[model samples]
Target: MSTERRTKVLEVLKTAEVGASLLVKGWVRTKRQNKNVAFIALNDGSTINNLQLVADPNQIAEELLKLVTTGACIAAKGDIVASQGSGQSVEMHVKELEILGEADPEKYPLQPKKHSLEFLREIAYLRPRTNTFGAVYRIRHAMIFAVHKFFNDKEFLNIHTPIITASDAEGAGETFRVTSLDMDNLPKNEEGAIDYKQDFFDKETNLTVSGQLEGELAAMALGQIYTFGPTFRAENSNTTRHLAEFWMIEPEMAFFDADDNADLAEEMLQYLVQYALDNCQDDLKFLHDREVEENKNKKESERPELYLIDRLKFVVDNKFERVTYTDAIDILRNSKPNKKKKFKYLIDAWGADLQSEHERYLVEKHFKKPVILSDYPKDIKAFYMRQNDDGKTVAAMDILFPGIGEIIGGSQREERLDKLEQRMDEMGVPKEELWWYLDTRKFGSAPHSGYGLGFERMILFVTGMTNIRDVIPFPRTPGNAEF
Candidate 1:
């Protein structure tokens, strides 16, 4: 192998200087051989597109060329040339080839053929090598960068919140506990209950379900802060929308109210959509076509109203319709679905929690655009949400999208210690557990607002992928944690 830098397939495809010596190394996607010539498609995760390598069997050993099958890794010294092929504009004329690794054709799970998403999930370690998942992951990475960039550009401090904490941010009681105690011989207190005091942290702790509480504390000091990290949920849900471990992007602004929070969330969503359209077109296009092919055979009623690229552009170009939860309830109650009993969870009352079907109907049918549903009932929302003048609803908002409902959920916080403590008591949440969180409200609390954007959900929208498991790599789900 040459001691020179390797040119990525992405760069190789864009090379203007033809006949330049280039060293490219990647796993072979496909290889076709004739009696005199052999062609190899190589990719190194630099791009979804592959670098076409042309080799002469007369020059390279037959045995060496035979090893360059599908899933084989190889290093090649070649010269970039204008391709005579129809698809790619340029190709590499390989002069020397080195087989770094070989995949036995008989044993390799993946071949040059189509595989179901379920089958691919079984072998997720190699799924990135596929066109569909490679595109998904590439877009995933672009969004990860875009997330940090969007926050950094707005001067929001990126805080690394603890994964393990003593408090459940959501107070839902569904949390994966983190303990260093023997189960067989558990320690007990005087009351004969399992004593958490003897645990590793000297108290009961679990994987954090959200970082918004701690993020709120930082926002109180830093003015604006965001936490982008993995959040866990112990709910045993195996649905398409849920995961045991997923990522969250929570951004808190100190001096912002409910309206300001909604505005910022809207701007961020538009910005992310625009960024993906501008920067990740190639990968997005691949996913777009893949989505199209996947949905083409389905009934017309079941297909998406707009394609992936079109929907992304629509989000960037249009303003989200802002509506109060009360008004939304009135609309839903009077809607045809509710009247005809089409909805599984009928919208009968004002305090009813809006289901995914209702949210989708509002965005896809009623609004015909993205929406910001605000002023949720106080009891339905978290204890931290600011109570409105009605005393029944909180200043909570949920941003609903076309295909996905409730892409983001945020609200203006209850800065007043009295109100917050009262709500905490009403919800039976022990204030003593989150002493640090309460300290922020007691000392220097401001009218802060924040929202959480599910990272995988964002990817689902951008990639037009139906299942949340496919967007995230190594999905942690109930009864499954396979690679």
Candidate 2:
């Protein structure tokens, strides 16, 4: 006969009374035995804390108790009772136990002690069992749920954007071309160019770099829309911030301007931070303690509480810093002495793209908090950004954090037909391809704005994980796609 399964460990802990007959199935984290009793720490991936199981040696049999080892999957029929021990508030008194799967302790890599993050990445399949990653991913899941809820409550339409497109959104020339024909044998045109007509799509196509353009179209028709999906970039730079394939959330509003866009982004971020803090308190606390322990061996002067829990608390309690690009440049110029010399790209120029180091310095050193840098030079920004009054800059914004530099990039789109055409022509954008997009302005258009939030970058910021590869499952980077 099949045994009965009552409730999860999280649900069991929520109960007030004990002595409830229940069945628990989970991997054994730690097991210790005396002459007549054995203590087993069981984890069901329900939460950070494990359930304590007290098994009677005489009733369960010594052979069954001996079979229990670290990482072994087991099921126990037990009655919960108030614990008299020092570890937990409640413990399970096992009446019958059965071994579902046995894991050899000699081969199991995980132990009760700490393991390096680098070491854990090598065993990616098993890293979820650890405390830090478990907490990080749990928060990630919760954040995703909160995002859907926020959009749903606001009456925003969820638009499903295409993953493959023929046009480039960022126009950065970093795109992964999609093809089916073998590279070794290809048809050549009269100019000795490879014939793309023989490709799978019968023409050139590529993985989309951003869903902002499509999202904008939907927003114009549906009023407000958002797209949350995977975006790909083929750039080869190996940095803590860059990922070849990452998730991006792009929300577009049809009748909003630059200030409205900023307000929406700020509200969304605050809501997400608060949601994580409230829903995953235990997981956040677990990550906080793990971060503290990891910093114990390092120099005390260099260590700080940069983990998820602390960062969430700080964001929830304080206001985010906001400054225009011109003022930001002035601040960076005045604070040049504190800037690292190894950063070769940031020169405090008027029309230069801000590097990660410069962004970090602005948030961490100058502001000591998250900052929104807005009104960037139009020449340096994308073609879609609305032109400012000065005609030299665009109404664009980037939200920067202390640990993670640029977590978000957004802009007020250019809705004027003539001005947008001029900008597109000057930027050498193929006007023929974007004729439909340009016609949207001719038919009916209003000032609109949106932004793209890098989902992995946000996770990295919250978890204090240094590398972008760690936060993403099955990361695809330059020359690396190992599952």
Candidate 3:
């Protein structure tokens, strides 16, 4: 309870002078007590490593020491001393111990044992106390910081886009509707249609699917802007890749073409990977080992080609392979997988949309590195992508990684008002609803481009976690939102 500033376990482990008295407050990860002495491993979630506190059984009361079990919070003041331990270099000699919170040993689900990820999700509230989730969350924080740092270093302004909006930017037709009207007896017009005008926004509104459209408006004025925020989709997918809600990183820039956009994306991703290697060494090592252990039992063909750390470094050290969609289609069509009838959806046609199998094969087998497949056919892409001179393909690009199909999706936006309207009409994109967006092209639209990176998917790639749910703190999936 002293007024002196508390010392973190990370600081003490990294740089603490021996014989200096300090205080550390954290939950007791494990405690071993014999008649002679007790060794308590305390963690405050500051780092992946825990600080070992050596306490004399006589000095610290039995009542106090007994409560310092796993899942119990404790504050200890002690003197720093050199450790004879294997993993850690320093340990604390505890002079004072206080229990801030106590977890009943009978009811506490987390113990000094391994629990499957499925079991952990059942108790998501206490899952963070586990070693695996702890490392995951720490890396999650690191990625968040690096995202802002990456944009800020490029002099890109961070914009807070609205969470609630009326536009279905992706036109996915699946959204969580926000309303204050009575559902039992809803307001209906003369045509017996539910009148959304009586709702909160006086129009049909739902959680936004993408911030790129609004980010463009700001880019037209601010030159360059980025939005890193939560986005929602109401699809009924229950795969490892689908989430009802997730975070997205969307950056819009003026005077940048599709090539410039691809270059920036590659640089940004590599920078983040290098940043993690430099800063989060301990946590990365833990997750890397975790991945190795997870893949040990699988078939060789199903196993990852490289270790987690090697995979990350390979991505940073090598340049991504750039290939056109037409070229990629040719390769896939003539490749052994398609020829041997191994592909789930065989690459039989040129204009057909590429599935996850096709994308992963291109990255993992065909290129043996990250690949940027560009100039997709206009019919398959969104309406905002710029139409090419050939009139069949758009200036679109998708960055594909080994395990994941497409990590980043973006395009050089259709800046011409006439061309944009024509695409909108062809796709039946309700141009009247996006009149303000049309105004952007009518007034002062410059050659601009942007992309959206799924924050969790990248984290999945970075942490080498298989399930998309594990990377996020509390996953919002189809039927599960429990915390």
lDDT (Cα atoms) of all candidates against the true structure? 0.91, 0.84, 0.91
Worst lDDT run of 10 residues, candidate 3, spans: 164-173
RMSD of each: 1.4, 2.1, 1.4
TM-score, model 1 to reference: 0.97
> Model 1: clashing residue pairs?
none
Candidate 3 local lDDT, 1-483, one digit each (tens): 645578998899889998889999988888888899899989888887899999999899999998988999989998998987776788999999988899998889998888899999888898888888998898888999999999999999998898899887567549998788998999999999999888989988889888888899999999999999999998888878778899999999999999999999999999989988888889999989988998899999988779989999999999999999999999999999899999999998889999888888889888999999999999999999999999899999999988877889999999999999999999999998899999999998799999999999999888888889888888899889987
**Cα lDDT tens digits for candidate 1, 1-483:** 846788888888865478798899999999988997899999998888998999999998888998998999999997889889898888888899999999999999998999999999999899989999989998999999999999999999999999999876567449998999998999999999999999999988999999998899889989999999999999988787788999999999999999999999999999999999999899999988888998989999998888999999988989999999999999999999989999999998889998989998999999999999999989888898999988899999999887777789999999999999999999988888778888888897789999999999999999998899999989999888766
lDDT of model 2, residue 184: 87
> Candidate 3 regions off by >4 Å?
2-4, 297-302
Better of 1 and 2 by TM-score: 1
Model 2 pairs whose backbones collide = none
TM-score of each: 0.97, 0.94, 0.97
Q: What is the TM-score (0 to 1) of candidate 3?
A: 0.97
Q: Please identify model 2 stretches exceeding 4 Å from their true place.
A: 1-3, 189-192, 305-308, 336-349
